[model samples]
Target: MSQKSAPRPPKTSPDATRRSEKSRRAIYAAALELVGEVGYAKTTIEGIAARAGVGKQTIYRWWSAKADVLLEAFLDLGEQAAEQAAGPGAEYGIPDTGDLAADLKAVLRATVDELLDPRFEVPSRALAAEGVVNEELGREFVAKLLDPSLQLYVRRLRSAQDAGQVRPEVDPRIALELFVSPLAQRWLQHTGPISYAYTDTLVDYALYGLAPR
Candidate 1:
């Protein structure tokens, strides 16, 4: 006589994957909103769990603490913005359209829109101000979020130099910063208002050399 075998459990499908993504987005949104409402020093893991409508265990299962969750949330926000700006699978890199001026302006224009969006701006300023005094977190923020995007600009600038769009003598690292850092400082420090005209001028000044040309 043959014995009946136990049935196998059903596997998760695309719908499950999508649901999980939705849950993750909710958790990130809750974390950002909470942090913005109450400074990071008071933002607690338990608070995030409550705000996210998940059990503490659920948050613990995914993140060690509020800091880890907030750090990754910001990183995910950047990737989402990049995907939206560049389109699906287009990469987060600066566009090498052969026209340096046009490409820089295009990227910077997207940046302007992102900066103006309250969802991005409020949380970012809270984090940035904290980073100004919190050295370790500041460095981590730079390494994880800022540096990667900056590197893409550097690589594109290097390629532009090879193609004769940029002068070969220009240091791609420093050269990329000419446009990037100005906008960063303005946004972070509120040194000036951001606009298309400002970033367009940055591109022109960076490419042409501000001294004489």
Candidate 2:
């Protein structure tokens, strides 16, 4: 017979756990607000801790660097946004409704709404502006935040291809840019207004050819 396994650690009390979660959320809020108010280069762990009303050591105990903390904070923000949009416990991913156009439009519309939200827009714009000048930081944050969302599109497109909606010859990665890049440009440049109807049109134009098909 095998030896008994080591005993499991005792669970944290509900009150203790609640306090920990509250502190963690406060940190995230403080980080987002600070980064938005002052660009990423200027934002610091000390400032975040002060804004969060916690000691510097409190933040250090959880995250090794400001970058790590910011990344997690953004990720938490995304999950919170997703939960608000798509009920609780909803995993952030594209909907695979089998109707390619409808599925694409649905996600894009949600994205348009997100881009318009000031809480997400301000800090993200700050980070994006900084990223344009700071290539290394840009790449790091893009890999952590943006690429995961892009990958969701890639997965959804691959599913469409498997279902025979998209041509097997077409590259899903490039195909997605047709709709995604346009919306991105508009948001970043203030070139055009963003709306559900606008995104719906993009999905239609992307899936169905621009020239008469």
Candidate 3:
């Protein structure tokens, strides 16, 4: 009896791989640019496909919806930024030098630089504004993007508590908002200028009480 023939692997080549990578980068760039220019409400799968010079089917092959595309695009942007900041293959995390204050300052200063970067700023602002009003999008944004970063702060603060740098009773989740929320408000509301100096001051005030010892 003849054995059933083995299934052939789907065709692929180096050139095809290169083209796929190129198309993906174009889609990501187009999505970010469109969001920055027109805001999220106006950004659509068709627009992204037209801007990227790819068929909408190309996008649909990978993502089910515009939100998925935009979310993944933002994630890719963040990964690129992290690699640039920390070097290729470097894991992203807060440093736990015995000096909690110094570590916090360093992180917040980096945050200031990231916030001021136009590539990150404009598209991020668009998404942030949308998330404020779109409850479903807001939940996804928090779950996928915002909460992971916040948890990093929570982990760092917990470390500080273990080291006696923070109060044992303090909730790391809430404690983090002391520094994080103010910077967010300032940036989101355009209430004040954001700078390394400003973030450093935030670290100080969050760690130290307003009243004198």
Best candidate, lDDT: 2
Write the residue-wise lDDT of candidate 3 on 1-213 in tens digits: 978698664588989988998999999999999999999999999999999999999999888999999998999998888889999978887888889989988888888888999999999999999999999998998899889989999999999999999999999999999888999999999999888888888889889978896
| Candidate 2, residue 37: how far the Cα is off, in Å | 0.9
Every model's TM-score: 0.87, 0.91, 0.93
Stretch of 10 with least lDDT, candidate 2: 1-10
Residue lDDT tens for model 1, 1-213:
978697664577989878767878888999899888887888888888798887788788778877789998998888888788778776676777789899889989889999998989888888888889999888988888788888878888888989998888888988888888899999988899999999999999888885874
The models' CA-based lDDT, in order, is 0.86, 0.92, 0.92
Q: What does candidate 2's lDDT look like per residue over 1-213, in tens digits?
A: 978698664599999888888999999999999999998989999999999999999899889999899899999999999999999998889998789999999999999989999999998998898889999889999999999999999999999989999999998889999999999999998999999999999999999888987
Candidate 3 deviant stretches above 4 angstroms: 1-11
Separately for all candidates shown, the number of backbone clashes (residues 3 or more apart, or on different chains) is 0, 0, 0
Candidate number of the best TM-score = 3
RMSD of each: 6.5, 3.3, 4.8
* Candidate 1: segments with Cα more than 4 A from true spot: 1-19
